[model samples]
Target: MRAMEPDRHSYISGVLVMEKTKLLYQQMYSGKVFTWIHLMPIFCSSMVRAQIQTNSDSKNLVTHKPTPTSEALSGVTVEPTRKSRSDSERPESLSKDLFTMSNLSVSDPELEKPANGSYSDVYEKYVLPCIAEFLGTAFFIFNGCASVTENTEGTGHLQPALAHGLALGIAVAIFARVSGGHMNPAVSLGAALIGGLNIFLLIPYWAAQLCGGMVGAALAKAITSDVKFFNATGAAFKSIERDEQVGSAIVAEVVMTAYLVMTVCMGTINKKSTTTLAPLCIGLSVTVGILAGGSVSGGCMNPARALGSALVANYWDYHWVYWVGPITGSLIVGLLLRVFIGDQKIRVLMT
Candidate 1:
């Protein structure tokens, strides 16, 4: 259930069978399960009719009617009908559990997607996910900013970089399924570019992420006593050396943001990715971004990160670099992914 896990599969299996059965009875699947269940007897009767009709011309047919018995059942090929193929042939979509295995269809034509198809589903589908994005981003930036605020010892800058990486990995592991764990606005925008998310929800995601980041940064300031150091470090991203001009900083942001967004597209956004280690891959991307460009452009691959720190610390220096660079890079990768690796093309897309 979690990206970082202690192997709770057995426990979750038990809960799945029990809780989903309850949901099935309570109409969680909108009574399609009920209809399917009631139809099974009729289906079995038809199958029996077909079987008996096929066997009637056999030379070894029983001559008289008889009561039901174990021997009679033994002769009947009364298979509990499977869908399309044997259970073993079913895809790992069954990993979602039996209730959610509503169909083996290759396309959405098998059933209408939304039973209600009303505005009410907006709350369940979009609002809750945005809430999760908010809370998860809050958790992410709070810890990450804390790391930055605490890194005032003049030691190497690796600690804050690793801290942000590890913190992001943990948050991603927790919130991946909930809201794609996109603590960064650039990542959410990238998701929108392709069709993983509804276009309407993108602004809400950005708002939640930016707000969560601001809250986290403000809270981090409250926790630390060294206001000067905290303000200085937590303000915003800046260039230090080589190509310190605005153009080079923008390039750094674009390259680093592209790397991060591209990995997310391949590892998590792409349906075909078999790697279960989304947290590890995405986190390492952040770490590498920091190590590679932290000294040059401060590795602010996420605009929300820079924006939040700037807002909290009241620092507005070079804030545009973070936003322009990341948005440009994410859009570039998003377009590339859409053309070459999107879900529409079978040769490139995952199922």
Candidate 2:
């Protein structure tokens, strides 16, 4: 019974050992298969990460590199970005350019050209006539007032007439280069009709002459006030006889002014005569007319000149006759010249 018990225990122990070995073999086989499956995916993931890193490094190199000379040879131009400028910088540059241009214009030697026909050609053509009329009228008023001032003890009709003639002559001569020397409204109107001057200029010239005459009269009054010879109200040397000889004054102004306008037209616009001496001739004509009729009419051939004197002298009695006579005479002479002399010769010569 003891021997049989020993054998049985040995057999049980052997069976238990065999079972443990089989279980260990199964666990080892399953672990090996699982490891094989996981290994491929881990290797693929590592390869992909390395490839991504290499691509990133290549991109960085491209961005950091300077432009190649080969690209330039192929006609590629790489321009740098410009920095933005501020608004405050633009006006300063513009101002500098303007100042430079102004300096050049003012300093140029060509500014003193006379009839050489440079610099303000348009001003010479369109604006000079009116300017002359204004200036001449002013001159006439100043000299006329001086002539008839009550304080000038030696002044008389002949003296005043000579003064008027001299003033008219000088003014015309000075402005002849710039304008044609049309100083009176009647003369301007007549010239426009006879010489084909622009009729549009008449109104402006008349206005300017009138206004300038008024200014000149005011200046003359201011100057005469300082002199002891002037009697403002009484008929000593400064006073004009306002109440005496109304009809005689009217007739004298009409006749004298008419003659003056006619003489101006004949001297200046007549194709048969030379106008180079027109200033002197016209002035002499006015002097003769004044000498003939100055005692009766005050010898005022120009309405503007007469009006200015009258206004300053506070005398408006014979104003209408002066206007009527000069205008009538101008119109009549203009018609006669147009009919007799004609503008054909002048136009042909000019052309």
For model 2, residues 246-265, the per-residue Cα lDDT tens digits are: 66665666666657766666
Q: What lDDT does candidate 2 reach at residue 263?
A: 68
The Cα local distance difference test for each model comes to 0.72, 0.62
lDDT, candidate 1, 1-351, per-residue tens: 442232243334334434434444445344343444533333343344434443442323335446677866789643232123333432232323343444422223334455575665777788878888888777777777777777767765687688889988998888888888889999998888876678888999999998888887888788877765455566456454344477888898999999999888788877777368888889999989988888778888988888888887777777888899999999998888876766664224443
TM-score of each: 0.64, 0.58
Please give the lDDT score for candidate 2: 0.62
- Candidate 2 TM-score over all chains jointly: 0.58
Clash list (residue pairs), candidate 2: 149-238, 150-237, 150-238, 151-229, 151-237, 151-238
TM-score of candidate 1 against the unseen true structure? 0.64
